[model samples]
Target: MKILVVDDDPGIRELVRITLQDAGYAVAAAAEAIGALSMLEAENPDLAIVDVMMPGMDGFALTRELKSFKDMPVLLLTAKGALEDKERGFRAGSDDYVVKPFEPKELLFRVEAILRRYGKEEEAPILAGPLEIDRQSYEVTCGSRTLLLPLKEFELLTILASRPNVVFERERLLELVWGLDYEGDGGTLSVHIKRIRGRLEGLTDRVSIVTVRGVGYKMEILP
Candidate 1:
């Protein structure tokens, strides 16, 4: 899973980044709230770790904004550990809160707990028109035909098919399907999309991957 760390403290940001990265998570860091907001789309983070005290926008306000913008869960990290501060964090839509002097293991545990609560541990089968994507089996079936796609192809298709007709930004898709550390260009993504389209062509014509011109791609289910 991917996590975004938003903090003004350089030391805190680096520490959290290293901690999460060591736990096998893709980490993205932002120095402040504005930068964090800007990275939201491209980062496509599953969760956000935000500091309470910020210059422009505080963590509580950012939590509200983040919750409003997406269904992503936010974990507020701050020095404040009072009962009222905790209540305020919850009121502001934070999924969880961690005090500044927290142990690295504790933070990881909390992150895992929140993700499990969000159902990120397991995904259900997705049905888009005639296509049925079984995430567990990594199989796509249309009618009587079954298409066994490559790992990357399957993940890419699954991401698009999960939200039919919703345009996925190219950068977002790359980060989701590939990884935060992917050094490749858009050509790789284009090629994968092309391959998926070719494989799906023989299985069914009802489902399609539509290019959104300069934006990215979306899955379309035709009647």
Candidate 2:
């Protein structure tokens, strides 16, 4: 597997490189967001491990941008263990999150686990007109241009894409994507959907999340 490791800290970058290389995987390293984006254009790596905090772009932004091109599994490494941080990671479209001061073995295991569970063979990209989704890599492509989508937006897209014309009540989206056991601000769901639509703007004539006339919401695919 070819992996891209992006982090501002040289020590962390080296640690990831050495560990993955020892495990027999091709790895690429980038210290900043611009470098990472450039490397992505050239390498087309199988997976990416991103650090949440950085000088400017940050891991969240990177994950969202990368989602436009490839569904490559991303494992976010961050010291912030707060729920908001984790939620932010998920919202940015990361496959998994790992807190800092973690064992290398643990990180490797989590990466392997995600790859195994949602392996390459199952990741056929989904295309709905201008929007494209790579199930395997979790990348979204719109025409030749790709849009960066936060993790929740990606999940919400996947759910909606699965049914196309099917209407999923707002509560259903909350339960399925956010998790039935998850407890957060209830308004967060609408905000997320709205953001997703904004990213997908101009791709279609109507809203993806259609109001069900006082019922809930449904994904409206262009015919």
Candidate 3:
């Protein structure tokens, strides 16, 4: 897991870096909100530790902005321990609150708890347009209709729908859907695609698997 520590104070920032790193996580530290946003553009952190009462944008404001784009958790660290302060943090989309001069062990526990909550959600069904795939239940649904596809066909569909509109080449899809060790010609891929299309036919007009001719296929969601 990766964590981004945002604090104006070098001491607090470095402390968080050391603590999380020792706990077996990758760490990135930034001075303030602007620098944190810049870091986000380059790399994505699994969680962010933000400090309240910064110079320009406070932790509450930063947490709000980050949550607007990402679905990850934000933890607030501050000197204030009043109930109102905690409420404000929650209002700003903070998943947890840690007071200043926090016990390192407690911080670690809270971080783990927050991550555990989201981990379950990550495995749940993924939805795009009218298509939905639930890995846990091994179910695929299009609109009100449920699809019953063979193992390979279902895997192929899930692979494409996971990243809708992103064109995947034949070699890449084969490598991902069928293991590299599998000895199968590319014609097998075409056959599976046809079967998947047949299952999707008339289920929903909003989604379709589009062939890229010489390339491979992509699950396209129509507006």
Candidate 4:
């Protein structure tokens, strides 16, 4: 796999290059956003790892630019750990965020997770021809409005929207939506369902999510 590593710090750039190269990935190193853009044009990489702080056109801005083309996976490697910074990264189109002073193993794991998420990502259904999902971008388009979802919400919507008219049991939803190791009860899934339903309130009468009596929930295809 090919990866573009962008960081202004030469030492950091070399370190990342060596580490990723050793792991059997073709690595392209860039010191600035312009250089990174040039490299992207020259060699369309599978993924990009960018540092948040740079002299000009920081990683956030670069990520915004990258998303304009298509749904490209971008991972942020930065020292900024505040929730705001993390949110900003996501808002800027980052697929994953890793805080600085991180373990190499942790970085490796995050990268793998992001790649896997993109690989297995499912496209959202046309939902009676109103809702559209671009799995790679995690974007839900309703009419002319396009909404960007948080990671968990995105995953949840993907699962339900992928299989319309099918009743997914509560246990199944918990395991799939909340993860296998999640300790929360069925209520957790309900919260997410409520949130999704709230967002689709206007369409609830048409493209609704139905509670399957004693079972769980199914995204009902309106007649």
Candidate 5:
């Protein structure tokens, strides 16, 4: 998971970044909301950790804007731990709230909870744009339509859709889906991708399986 941390305090920003990174999450830090907004345009981080106090816009306002316009989850991190502060955080559209003087383990737990609730937990339904891959039911849907795909194709799509815009190297995907014990040529992967692409054609306008020549592939969801 990728988390963007927004805080005016350099110490706090570094602290959060290191904490999340140590917990095996990709992280980016922004000093304010505007910088966070710019990062959102460049890459779609899974969630954002926002500070409640900043120079131009407070975290409440930023959370409201992100929830209203961007439809993204925000976790408010601040020193305000009163009951009313949490209420305000909820009203501002924060999915989770954390106080500054918090245990790192507790923060990780809360983050996991929010991610699980949103179907982003490990092995949950992989959602990206208009596509959803339900691992439980082994079903794939794009837009309003459900697609029937071969086992290999479905697995391939699941891997890509689970982490949208994250480039997966060919070897890495092969290891994950086909297993390290399974011996297969690169053509096997190519064929599977082609089949998946064929099934996805015209099914959704937002999803695109992009090939990064000589490297790997990534699923891009265009707005």
Candidate 6:
């Protein structure tokens, strides 16, 4: 998974970046909130580690803004560990808070916990417009029609439909669906997407997989 680290302090940014990178997560860092917001689309990070104290926009404001922009989880890191400050952070849509002068292991633990919670939440059936994706049964149902897909196609559709309108990068999709060791070109992904698209075309018009040009693909839920 990819993580975005936002902090004004260069030292803290590097420290967090190294910590996450060492744990096998792709890391991106920005010195301020604005730059972090700008990186949202291109980075498509699964989680964001945001420092609460900054020059222009504080972590609280940034957390709210980030939630409005994407569905990813946010962890607020700050020196303030008081009740009111933590309440404020939580009120601003932060999934978790980590006080400064923290142990790297503790930070990593909290990150894993939050991610686990999110994964559990997504374990339920996903309803995207007219499509219903059941991860358990590996079934895709569109209205009254039940569409069966190959293993790769089903996994790809499950990922896209689970997060409607979220742009999933091609490499990320490959890793999630085809496994990290899969030695395949982008053409394989394209072929599978084409097949899924063909299946959806015959089933429903409200849901579609949109090719995002240089990016990858996203499930678009049309009205």
TM-score of every model versus the real structure: 0.55, 0.53, 0.54, 0.53, 0.54, 0.54
Give me the candidate number with maximum TM-score.
1
Runs off by more than 4 Å, candidate 4: 120-223
Model 1 earns a TM-score of 0.55
Per-residue alpha-carbon lDDT of model 5 for 73-140, expressed as tens digits?
78899999999999999998999999977666567668878888887766656777878888657788
Taken over the whole model, the C-alpha lDDT of each candidate is: 0.87, 0.77, 0.82, 0.76, 0.81, 0.85
Give a tens-digit lDDT track for model 6, residues 1-223.
Answer: 8889999999999878766654446898999999999999999988889999999999999999988886679999999899999999999999999998876667876887888888822356778898888866888897788977888898789778767888888987876666556697999999999999899999988888999999999989988
Give the lDDT of residue 190 in candidate 5: 92
Q: Give the least accurate 10-residue stretch of model 3, judged by summed lDDT.
A: 119-128
Extract clashing residue pairs from model 1.
none
The whole-model C-alpha lDDT of candidate 6 against the native structure comes to 0.85
Candidates 4 and 6 compared by TM-score, better number: 6
Question: What's the lDDT for candidate 2?
Answer: 0.77
Best by lDDT: 1
- For every candidate structure, what is the RMSD over all alpha carbons to the true structure, in angstroms? 10.8, 16.0, 13.3, 13.3, 11.2, 11.2
lDDT of 4 by residue, 102-187 (tens): 55545655776887887832233434347786756777777787778777776667666766777777876665545446787777
Per-residue lDDT value at 113 in model 2: 81
Please identify model 2 stretches exceeding 4 Å from their true place. 121-223
Question: What C-alpha lDDT, on a 0 to 100 scale, does residue 13 get in candidate 6?
Answer: 92
Summarize candidate 2's per-residue lDDT along 1-223 as a digit string, tens digits. 6889999999999978866754446899999878999987789888889999999999999999888767768899989999999999999899999998776667766877877866642335666655678755678876576665777788778767665676667766675566546688658987887787777675555436676765666677665
The residue ranges of model 5 lying beyond 4 angstroms of the native Cα positions read: 124-223
